[model samples]
Target: MIRGIRGATTVTSNEEEEILEVTEELVNEIIAQNSFLPDEVAQVLITVTEDLSATFPAKALRRFEDWTYVPVMCATEIPVPGSLEKCIRILLTVNTTAAQNEINHIYMREAIKLRPDLSSTKRLAQ
Candidate 1:
């Protein structure tokens, strides 16, 4: 069956390095949490808030060796008046046997406020 995993993270700055660093961290966490195999991933879609334009989050994902075979796309998130800033969100489409409720969705850094219920940042360290 096909499943979609959602994840989000925030960066401190619009610099290319900062954006890439946070993005990589977020991606790694998503993979580890979901136990996702590279081959199992159908596609990855990334969206960044308008405040972050230093680079496309998808560009940073290409630097990973395991992601070379995975197709990734990027877009600008719809800017809502009160939305969080410097946020990068991703949706991964994967083929897996796990049910929807069993899937892990990650939210990290300041983005945690966006979804306190699903945010695992504080829980992991504890």
Candidate 2:
């Protein structure tokens, strides 16, 4: 079965470095929490808020040499009034046997507000 795993994170600035660093951290946490291997990921859809134009969040995956084989696309998020700024969101469609309820969705930084109830209470690494 194919399951969608969701993860979101916020960058401190519009700089490319900050965006890449935070995005990579977010993806790492998602895969770690879900026990997903790169080969199991069929597609990755990444989006950033309107204020973040310095870089695409997908670029962060380049840090992982094995992740190059996974398909990744980036887009701009729909701007809504009072929405979080500098946020990057990812929806990963993976081929896995895990039940939907077993999938762990990660929300970090200010983006945690997007899914407070689903977000884990585990302390995040600095």
Candidate 3:
């Protein structure tokens, strides 16, 4: 089965360092929580809010040793009115035997407010 794990996080600023740092942290938590390997990831779609333009969030995946072959794409999020700023969202598709409900969707930092209904959104200790 193919499962899509949703995750999002916010950066304090639009700096490249902050963007990369938060992106890595978000993806790392998703991988850890789901217990998945990079080879199992079919693709990763990343989107950043209009307020963030320092760098492509996808670049952060390169820092992962085994993620070299994983396909990733990055885009700009739609600038809806009153939308979150300096935010990065990811839709990570992976091949897994686990059911959809078993998948963990992580929302970290200020992005936790984006999906309060998902129990997975409960903030994990930093």
**C-alpha TM-scores of all predictions:** 0.93, 0.93, 0.94
TM-score of 1: 0.93
Candidate 1 per-residue lDDT, tens place, 1-126, comes to: 999999899988899999998889998988888887889999999999999999888887887777788999999999999999999999999999999888888999998998888887654764
Worst 10 residues of 3 by lDDT: 117-126
Off by over 4 Å in 1: 122-126
Q: On lDDT, who's better, 2 or 3?
A: 3
lDDT (CA) per prediction: 0.89, 0.88, 0.90
Tens-place lDDT per residue, model 2, 1-126, is 999999888988899999999999988888888887899999999999999999878888988869988999999999999899899999999988999888888999898899987675442431
Residue range with the least summed lDDT across 10 consecutive positions in model 1: 117-126
What is the RMSD, in Å, between candidate 1 and the native fold over all Cα?
1.5
The global Cα lDDT (0 to 1) of model 1 is 0.89
| Rank ordering of all candidates by lDDT, starting from the highest | 3, 1, 2
| Full-model lDDT, candidate 3 | 0.90
User: What RMSD value applies to candidate 2?
Assistant: 2.5
lDDT of 3 by residue, 42-66 (tens): 9999999999999999999999998
